[model samples]
Target chain A: MKVLVIGAAGMVGRKLVAALLAAGQINDKAISSLTLADVVEPSGLGIDIAHTVIATDLSEEGAAASLIAERPDMIFHLAAIVSGEAEADFEKGYRINLDGTRALLESIRLASQSEPYCPRLVFTSSIAVFGEPLPAVIGDEFQQTPLTSYGTQKAICELLLSDYSRRGFVDGVGIRLPTIAVRPGKPNKAASGFFSGIIREPLAGLEAVLPVADTVRHWFASPRAAVGFLLHGAAMDTAQLGSQRNLSMPGLAVTVGEQIAALERVAGPKAVALIRREPDAVIADMVAGWPKAFEAKRARSMGFVGDASFDEIIEIHIADELSGKVAL
Target chain B: MKVLVIGAAGMVGRKLVAALLAAGQINDKAISSLTLADVVEPSGLGIDIAHTVIATDLSEEGAAASLIAERPDMIFHLAAIVSGEAEADFEKGYRINLDGTRALLESIRLASQSEPYCPRLVFTSSIAVFGEPLPAVIGDEFQQTPLTSYGTQKAICELLLSDYSRRGFVDGVGIRLPTIAVRPGKPNKAASGFFSGIIREPLAGLEAVLPVADTVRHWFASPRAAVGFLLHGAAMDTAQLGSQRNLSMPGLAVTVGEQIAALERVAGPKAVALIRREPDAVIADMVAGWPKAFEAKRARSMGFVGDASFDEIIEIHIADELSGKVAL
Candidate 1:
């Protein structure tokens, strides 16, 4: 099977590409060719299989058509303008996120007109699709009432995916992923950046800021598990999804306290001591409206797995990024 | 306040126009001008204050911009490619229903750029947004996993409305109308057309086909009540809506047997006898996936009302369509 991974330059995207190259197959079918695309050129890392990297803007006219011209059998769409950026710039957000996704779907549908083609499309959605006055644990049946522009874009894209799939233009599996923890890299300015920074910085024997109270709970999955979800979504029998093409992927629910406890268990108290407490009111107010957990019944039933616990999540980060050892 | 009705030729739109002209004001604000637009020119209808009608398609280039140029203070966007047509023609469905709505929104946002003009935008959505695996009664929080292309378009529009409102671009209120019962017109090819056909044809002293079983249940609101919902949606304080701009309007849930019983009570057995039962397996299968009832608590709390009962719904049709008497 040939595959195209859009948004292949980002952290998760790069990780997914590496994993795909390592496995060299999806659903037991060998990966014969790979096409990676993003706004900036993605590195194939000189992998052996037939590899190609292209830098393209999906919102640009004819960009999606060119990408869909060859029509790789499996497509992973992970590209998105992040939440803060989308919220800050409305038109840009709608252009890149909403229009970009629509362009891709339209191109695919148009491509299948002459030849009968239905590629397996795996779209990454976000928990931001659910907003304020949420339940303690949001069920799979909960409506998507997105409060932010970014969430709205993702929700709309999910709808398009379902409709396109229903029309038999594409075989789409949209997984609403949880917040990825222990995101390997420098601490970013995103409000949710603290979730990973607290764990990552401390593990690296560097001081990190804790902006909210320890009771600030959220749903989380390791980057490795996120990649696992994409693979499962790509390979799964979509007939099981029926009319509902989207699912909230399973994730471990934990609070700041739980994450700290896990860190203490894995590393010593000294490693945990690198944390600094500081309350940020703006972030707290925003996080108040965020989803803390999900039932994710459908995805779990479909064989998609999540991290066992925060300990496992931290361990995955340690093994993957830290060379199996915490700097502390 | 200047008003613009986008789908002014439709049944509800015409009634709303008549109601507006009769009252000569909305929410105690004197109407200054009226602009009625549709794919076909809507009659400015003779007895009116400053009126204009335009035959235009929203999907066309610069059409939405031209409409927004005048910047009417209140806008009623009731246009859509109906369900069956949309399902049959996929590209046309997206082009008109989805892209048209987006164009209107984009124009509104751009109109705001020169001078901040936030119009009262009352968008009409539908119950088709919900699908199968439904609970006995869907609540305000039920997920919208539409089984059809039309439903998907409405769901996406609803999300857009919410996001636009959240950004303060437009004061938008999207009401998901129940199936309008006893729709004052010829029965069309819509699978759900029978819902109105049974009530309408019987009252008109004509034979009507009942394609589904008497046990089949569905949600409905009278044309008068639907117009009432629209007017309320246009005038009500949107500040009360918060971030969730869309609502499932209150409707009477009745089984086909209940509709027959109500028909009998309203216009006697002779009128009820006009309904000929011919169970259609295709229609039965379609109706089975529709939403039966809703806990429209949000709309109800916001003072939007529904028909008192199925009898009231029938009476509404009789009084409004038959001049207070059944044709039978």
Candidate 2:
């Protein structure tokens, strides 16, 4: 089985590529070739597989058609502009997120008309799909009323994916991933970036700003688990999904205080002390509307795994990104 | 205020046009001109209002831009291919329902850029947005996991409406209308046609087929009520909607048995005798996945009126379509 990974240059996409190459197969089907695509050509995808890396923008005319021309057996679409950028530049967000995904689906449909072609499509959605007036624990069936253009784009793509899949044009699974914690990278200015920075920076002996209070709760998963979700979405028995092709993946719900407690458990007081408290009301207000927790019963029943705790999420980050080492 | 009705030729559309002409205004604003657009020219529009009737398909390349060129102050976008047809023809369904609506939105946004222009965009969504695994009484926050392509299209439109409205590109309101009963028309092959047929045909002294069991329940409103929902959508204070611009319009939920009883009560047993049970499993299975009832607290609280009972729904048909006289 050949595999195509869009947004292969991004953190999760890169990890997914490495995992796919490490396994050398999906569901015991021998992987033959790979196509790695992004806005910039993906690099250093180890020499174990026959692969081609293409720098492509999906929303451009004929871009999706060209990408699907080779017809990979499984496709993982993870391309998106971050929420801050999408909200700031409305036109660009719709073009890249909404039009791009729709173009890919349309291209696949057109390709299928030539002969028979139905590939397994795994799309990465986000918990941003859920908005304010949320329940304490959002069950498997909460409405998707995204409050941002980025979230709206994801929700729209999920609908398109389900409709296209139901029509037999493709086999699609959309997994709404939690906010990945301990994201293995330097902190940027994203409001939610603090979720990862408060862990990653402190582990590196760097003081990280804590914008919200200790009681600010949110859903989280490790980057490793997010990649696992993509794989599971690729290989799962879609028959169990019935008509609803999209699902919110299981995740750990933790408050800032709980996260700090986990940090203390994992790396002691030194790492925990590195988090500097600096209240920013703007970020706090935005975070308040986010989904705090989810039941995710359907995804769990379908065999998708969740991290045991915030400590486990941190452990995975250290193992994968820091080579199991802490600066202290 | 100038008004444009995109589907002035459809069942509810024709009724809406008639009501608008009769009122000569909306929310006390003196109505000026009208633009009636559809796949075919809408004819016989009352000359009380100066109007332009255009035969236009919204999915066409420049149709939406042309429609919005004059920029009517309030637009009612009620055009769509029905459920069964959208399911049968995939491409056409996406073209007409999905792309057409998106085009209209994009056009409106572009028009706004030239000058300050934000129209009251009242879109007619359907309860088809909600599907099975449904609660006995679906609440305002129920997930929109539609089982069919038509429902999927409507749900997508609702998302776009909310997003666009939130962004200040348009002042939009989407009302998810219930299954309109006692339709004033000839019998049709649509799966849910029986919902209207049993009442419409019987009242006209004609035989009507009942495909599903008596216990099979569904949500409904009358032609008059459906038209009222549209008018209210156009005239209501959208600020009350907050970021959620869509709503499930209130309607009566009744079983087929209750419908027949209402028919008996309204036109006596002679009219009820005109109904014949055919027991179509295909239609039955399809109907099974449909939403039964909704709490509709949100729409109700917003001052949108609902049909009092199934008996009122039947009475509406007689008063409006039958000229207050049943043929029995």
lDDT of 2 by residue, A1-328 (tens): 9899999999999999999999899999988999999999898766567998999999999999999999989999999998999999999999999999999999999999999999999999999888998998999988999999999999999998988998899999999999998888778878999999889998999999999999999999999899999999999999998879999999999999999999999999999999999999999999999999999999999999989999999999889889999999
Candidate 1 regions exceeding 4 Å error are none
Each candidate's fnat? 0.92, 0.86
On residues B1-328, what C-alpha lDDT tens digit does candidate 1 reach at each position?
9999999998888999998899899989998998899999997466547788989899999999999989999999998899999999987888888899999999999999999889999999999899998998999999999999999999999999999999988999999999999888898999999998998998888999999999999999999999999999988998888999999999999999999999999889998889998989999998998999999999999999999999998888888888997777
> RMSD, each candidate, Å?
1.1, 1.2
**Number of backbone collisions per candidate:** 0, 0
Which ten contiguous residues of candidate 1 chain A have the minimum total lDDT? Answer: A43-52
- Look at candidate 2 and tell me the lDDT of residue A57: 99
lDDT at residue B49 of model 2 (Cα atoms): 64
- The reply for model 2, stretches above 4 Å from the true place, is none
- Candidate 2 residues B68-92, lDDT tens each? 9988999999999999999999889
